[model samples]
Target: MGDFVKEILVKPIQYADEVVKLADGAISFRQDCLEVKTKSEKLVSLLRQAARASGDLYERPTRRIIDDTEQVLDKALTLVLKCRANGIARIFTIIPAGAFRKITQQLENSIGDVSWLLRVSTPADDRDDEYLGLPPIAANEPILCLIWEQIAILCSGTIEDRTDAAASLVSLARDNDRYGKLIIEEGGVGPLLRLAKEGRMEGQESAARAIGLLGRDPDSVEQIVNAGVCQVFAKILKEGHMKVQVVVAWAVSELAAHHRKCQDHFAQSNVIQLLVSHLAFETIQEHSKYAIPTKHAMSIHSVVMANNQKNDMDVTDANYRNNEQDDECKSKIQRPRGCQRIVKCTIW
Candidate 1:
């Protein structure tokens, strides 16, 4: 193929990357932008795989697929621009919410076309899969193929792709302990840890949920913890939105359940303080005439472990019983065995 043709074929993939970047920057319809970003990423992956194989990318079938992909990406780019604009002043010119639905379906169709092209296009017998950056597995099990695909997407540069991959991993991990172990074995934790820090709030929440489910195997949960999941979770718990905070709390609880080693690791990360702030009592300034509530700060582990045991749990204290005490209140947190702390709580 001529240089011009190769450049023509490469433009769509480049455009897809651009779409992924701008989609993440969208200030409105962010979730829909994520959908656009994920689908565009799939197209990029599929198109690159097709190019890497020995198949003639400039041939009619591959050329047609690239052309269609570019058209879809053109629409996606337009949509992303509108989303970023927020359309507040667009009035009659505003893009409809359903526009995202149509664009996503078109992108999905393009992805399917590229996948089909990759499946049917014959490559040189000596082609090395390593050059393609895709698993060359020819397995009968669809689940195995699915797992590898998601793992590859997990390693993608965009948060939307990683978030989508993590959500899928959660589903796959839930199937059995074996798949969960396989995910960890395949080194999915590194990107996930990156996602926890770099992804948007929605993506971070999904990553945390997936990390918790992957902790089903205590053996591999330690791998995640050793990869600094505690530090990441602590950061999220400290700074992330409340929904994400709750998810990370659950993951922290899962990891901490495995060993005292993990708990100590979390303690060093100061996750204990972040977790406490969640269950912290209302401050005296928030409400003056409220009831004398009994609440205590607990580690993420203790908070989770104490949830079901809340009926049997109690706070032992010598602090002021007077609801109107102006002094700081100190209380003894009594929960499960091994989880006892003197935590200070406010009276509401």
Candidate 2:
């Protein structure tokens, strides 16, 4: 069967499909290829070879490589997982940090969307466009779609929409409980840190979110901190957009959740101020509800760390308690609540 596949099925794709017999033969070969055992060394070699071959056709039929890549990835991922079924997780334990770093560089270069790129990396950093090529203006949606497709292969068929793949990676980073088993402690961190520094606000936000997730794992957190992810997040907190602000705030909170020292670092970086300011102006219900208060808590934590300033900052006040009550009343009355509590009534 392997010989039949190599001879009758695989060999014919190389020739012109002018005759009806050739097209039929190619179809039969594709079917045979699909039926090949996931553990077959031949299939693995074929996939790797096909990927390399796609490179030679780089200038022409770039789309063919893209299409073939999709097929190859789909098949290879199944094989890789099957190979890992037994103590495969142990393989990553021996894999060096530098090895994961190299793979991550190649992965980022192959991505096709800049906005999607930003979500996956740092918003302020420049991308390696020379390797990825200028993002096709007409291909934004399609590239984003393909990026998600690749991510889905990594995720266990749980992700259907590609848009969620980047977010899923971020989520993986934040809560090692979800994907820490499949992904190495260092597997997702390097690309995330690099993204945390480059591209656009959306990309950086995504990377920051992942960094935050990665920090939840004890092993991952130490490496990310050692790699200076916190410093990058602090920079974004000061200069990024609302979405970027929210993710960075969450990432910092996750880092602080694991280590008290992170609070002190954030304080020294003046990130506490930015978090406070963002909480002050945030209006989106989700942002105001989760992010703003969480950031405020982190800020107050920073204050505590900086001065032992156990100033009894009311948790309710920190929760935007006054504004929320007013909103609740206004919604019930169907009218804007006017200024009603301006009298000087000190809580003495």
The candidate maximizing lDDT is: 1
What's every prediction's RMSD, in angstroms?
Answer: 21.6, 19.1
The superposed Cα distance between candidate 1 and the true structure at residue 251, in angstroms, equals: 0.9
lDDT of 2 by residue, 195-314 (tens): 556546666666676666666555556676777775777677667665676667667777667775666666777776666655444333223233323344466534443332222234
1-348 per-residue lDDT for model 1 (tens digits): 434445665878788988989998887789999989998888888767766753343244455557777888888898888877745444444778689999998898787767754543333232333233222221245565566556555553356666777888888887888888877876678777888788888788888888888887568878988888988888887787766776777777766665446777777888877666555532322332332333676556444444534432332132234554324333424222111121221101
Worst 10 residues of 2 by lDDT: 339-348
Question: How high is the CA lDDT of each candidate model?
Answer: 0.66, 0.43
User: Which pairs of residues collide in candidate 1?
Assistant: none
RMSD of 1: 21.6
Scored by lDDT, model 2 comes in at 0.43
Task: State residue 342's C-alpha deviation in candidate 2, in Å.
Answer: 28
